[model samples]
Target: MGNINPSLLHVGSTLGAVFMALMVIFIRLKASARPVTLRKIWIPPLGMSTGFAMFVVPEVRFPWWWAVTAFLIGWFIFAYPLMRSTVFEERDGLIYAQRSKSFAFILLGLLLIRTVLHEFINRYVSIPQSGGLFFILAFGMILHWRVYMYKRYTRMALPKAPIPQPRG
Candidate 1:
């Protein structure tokens, strides 16, 4: 295989991350315009599960410790803010993802952090390995956030039990 240029790879990955961030923002806006459903709540992470296939490539494999650490960091640190910023509301008897003022800023912040961390980690790891680690991190974040949302959605969607009335 031909040697790859580090500079080109860096630029390409950064651009790709930026493009994805923008798409997330656009999709969120569109999604908010309609009623949210249980199917919609679960689709993203389930669809994202397909990305686990990347591990089948030898170059993308990383140590299990690194994967665990990345997943934990994403779950404990990153997911918290995302969960807090994402909220749901009911309007006309349908649930919808409430528009949060902080959601966009949080996404931009995460993108910047990922870009900087990618530059640092690439010095010590191959590009594919770094991508794998980052992928784990992102999956953890999305999974945790989605689970939280799922729980909240179910609670809101469920019909409430009526309290027993005392005999007059």
Candidate 2:
């Protein structure tokens, strides 16, 4: 449609490729046996915030309902599955998480679905509006995932109750 910008496709594809590469590295690092720390759990959200900021435009006028819908969809599609699949454990006073590789495949599938939706939406909406929608969607998913991870990490890292001493 007339609203579609040819350059937007190039930019989105390039960004998607870079995101996929980073995700691969992220998955590998998370899958390692290193103890999970508050810092580690916090990093992804911080990085995602930066990415989200890039797509935000002052001129974009997206509807509140659309944003809410996008956020809910992102939460259910991305965050819920990720939270359910992650395996957390406590060993020797350290918290560790076993990252599921299947999540990467799931992410890829979601990305593909988003890409197709973007193509359809771009024909009807301005690029900034679509970009803003995507930003909110990703922000919601990452925020939910990080919050759950932080809770899980804290719960696992808590000190165990000491055994009661027998009366002497």
Candidate 3:
């Protein structure tokens, strides 16, 4: 296994990863900084930041499928459901969560794509790929974002907390 610098990939080539990351950031900022009375604004952005930070992690040699399996597990636990839900309102100043879900999705997709291509398709596809310890962290981040979103969706979906009628 080898370390891959994200810079090596053209900004356009990994547009999915880049776009999702940006959305994650933008959504968190919008959700957290607003006038809404959100219970936990720190959740969503933390996930995103963690995932993005994974890109630069040091190298570690691991089986190719091991990487893919790890990523899929993370997504199943965090990314999938978070992306499935839609945001309707923010109790606090938090941006809608699902809007940022794509970021996690795109990121996972990139990792998996790179892993598979490097292992199997590289001989034919002729495209650059990123690998190493960074993927482990990136996978976790993708899950964390889902956790953050899940928290929000869970609260909204199953709540007995008296909807404190907004004080006019």
Candidate 4:
């Protein structure tokens, strides 16, 4: 324990987060407005849920209220901005989405916020509790963002009603 360096841990985490943010920025830059499928839209939430399940320990005790609060905060603070930053358009018979640069910045901001909060929580909470809470927070953000995207895509994909023909 005496040999462990807290600054090193913080530096490593920050570096990893910066790398991820850079990757996201690169991906966003290369991504163009394209037609999206239902299957693709559902993948994020499903993946996040699966990851949450994998991280969850059956024996570790977690506060239910804390999880709920984290989830709600993630949903409102992170997910809403991400969803709003995504621009959707209907072209021809397909639904297309173009995520703005602000989306990447918002994601980076969320990552930074989560990291700071995790470090703060680590001061008073056990590792298991902090990890579990963070997992729940990420799950909520991804779930809400994907669900909103799915709904928006489906609504935009719906067939428009044909105009009524006037009497000849």
* Top candidate by lDDT: 1
Q: What is the C-alpha lDDT profile of model 1 across 1-168, one tens digit per residue?
A: 158787787788889989999999889988999988888878999998899999999988988999999999899988998999988999999999988878889999999999889989999999989988998999999999999999999999999999999999
Ranking by TM-score: 1, 4, 2, 3
Task: State the C-alpha lDDT per candidate.
Answer: 0.91, 0.74, 0.50, 0.75
TM-scores for candidates 1 onward, in order:
0.95, 0.76, 0.30, 0.79
- Tell me the spans in candidate 2 whose CA falls farther than 4 Å from its real position: 1-11, 14-18, 21-31, 51-56, 162-168
Model 2 whole-model lDDT (C-alpha atoms): 0.74
Looking at model 4, the pairs that clash are: none
How well is each residue in 12-107 modelled by candidate 4, as lDDT tens digits? 756876796788678656554557788877776776676566444663347688889989987887788878887788778777777586877788
Locate the minimum summed-lDDT window of 10 residues in model 1: 1-10
The pairs that clash in candidate 3 are 20-103, 31-93, 31-94, 31-95, 32-94, 36-92, 37-91, 37-92, 38-91, 38-92
**Cα TM-score of candidate 2:** 0.76
Q: Which 10-residue window of candidate 4 scores lowest in summed lDDT?
A: 52-61
Best by TM-score: 1
Cα error, residue 71 of model 3, in Å, equals: 3.5
TM-score computed on alpha carbons, candidate 1:
0.95
lDDT score for residue 42 of model 3: 51
Instruction: Assess candidate 4 and give its lDDT.
Output: 0.75
Clashing pairs in 2: none
Candidate 1 backbone collisions, by pair:
none
